[model samples]
Target: MTGRITFWFDFASTYSYLSVMRIGGLAAARGISVSWKPFLLGPVFAAQGWNTSPFNLFPAKGRYMWRDLERICAARGLSFCRPDSFPQNGLLAARLALAAAEEDRIAAFTQAVFQAQFGQGADIADERVLQGCLRVSGLAPGLVQRALDPAIKSALRAQTDEAIAMGIFGAPSFTSGAELFWGDDRLEQALDHAAAVTI
Candidate 1:
């Protein structure tokens, strides 16, 4: 049996950027099928009585995270640049990613967005940036308009609700059947669990 896992991420999550860039190759190597699920963290954070990213709510952790991210990106040979904004609004990006999923271009589109934001420090909330990402992913920039469809908006909302129900309090989460793993560092453990549980 082939392993299968669902990757839950928010476009604004710094750790999620790491997993997004690396999950493709890792999953392919282990012959694990991946489902890229884009969700918003705002609601989840609110549920926990927080008004913003924990990185912002806690300054010390935020400082450590940025430096840690820098070191990790350097080690992996991936570009790293802190965006002017800690958490750029990702509502538009998430919707577009769902649109890309329909055409089976989610992986490419997602990587492009992450690179644009974390690698080049672009503002993902900007439609122009999103359109550029779409183009580079070999998708039509017009999808930006399509992403505004009511159906797309509702889908994103529903996805976020689902994430909450799954007990996913953070981005870069993975689920293998009923097992849940959080954080980029747990990625391999999640994949291994999926593979081992395959029947």
Candidate 2:
């Protein structure tokens, strides 16, 4: 039986960067279909009475998160530049990715966006930056404009609303039925659980 893995990722999330880089091969080996569902965690946090990443809400943990990211990226041979802007606006990027999926190029788009944000320190909110990402995926810039259309915006809004309803409060959340898993650390377990449940 094939299992569906709903991946709730936030582009600004560091841990999510690691998962995106790693999950593909892991899921393939397990014969799982990884559904990439990108969404913003900020709006969810706002509703939860929090203003920022918990790492940011706490000074020491925030500091440690930075240093830890540097070490992890180094170990994985990945770039670790913390963008001057924390939690770069990812709403538009996510919308564009969903738009790319409609064109059958979501994998390329996802890789490019992840590399642009986590690897190259590119500004995700900038139209030029997004266009560059789309170009890297061999996609036309026009689709991004389409993603901003009323129809797509409504879809994106609905996705966010559904995520909130699913008890998702953070990026890197995963779900199999009503089984909710939050955080990048839980990604593998979620995948395994979904696969096992399907079996």
Candidate 3:
């Protein structure tokens, strides 16, 4: 059986960066389609009484995460840098991604934004950086302005709300049918689940 998996990620999520860079090729080999679903972690965190990422709320976990990301990236031959902000503002980036989704440019834009933030330490919230991402993704730079539209903003909010309703509390989560898998590490398992399901 062949099926698709929804990849729910937040721009500010480091592990999400890893998953985003690798999911395409992996899923393709397994004959599984991927749906890139970008959402905000802010409301999710807020609902749990936290204003910041768990990495920031808990110091030890935060430190380990950075080191862990470094090792993972190194192993994968992907560049890695620690952004000044633990969890950067992903609002604009998420909005842009949703806008790009209409034109099937979400993959390009999403990767560019993630690389800009986690690979180069660029601030994803910076308009200039986002404009650059749009250009790099072969999309019109004007799309950046479109990302600010009320509709795009609402779409992002709706997506986030959907994520919450789906019981997604973290980024880089994957879902195949009713099976939910969280974290970059679970990517293969999610794909396997999708591939094994009877159509």
Steric clash pairs (candidate 3):
none
| lDDT score, candidate 3 | 0.92
Top candidate on lDDT is 1
Q: Between prediction 1 and prediction 3, which has the larger TM-score?
A: 1
Residues forming the 10-long window of minimal summed lDDT in candidate 3: 138-147
Model 1 root-mean-square deviation: 0.8
Q: Which residue window of length 10 is worst by lDDT in model 1? A: 190-199
Tens-digit lDDT string for candidate 3 (33-116): 889999999999999999999999999999999999999999999999899987899898999999899989999999999999
* C-alpha lDDT score of every prediction, in listed order: 0.96, 0.83, 0.92
Backbone clashes in each candidate structure, one number apiece?
Answer: 0, 0, 0
Stretches of candidate 2 off by over 4 Å are none
Candidate that would win on TM-score: 1
lDDT (Cα, tens digit) per residue for candidate 2, span 65-150: 88987888899898767777777888888899889978888767877887888788888889899899899898998997889888
lDDT, model 1: 0.96
Error of 1 at 36 (Å): 0.1
lDDT order, best first, reads: 1, 3, 2
Total clashes in model 3, counting residue pairs 3 or more apart in sequence or in different chains: 0
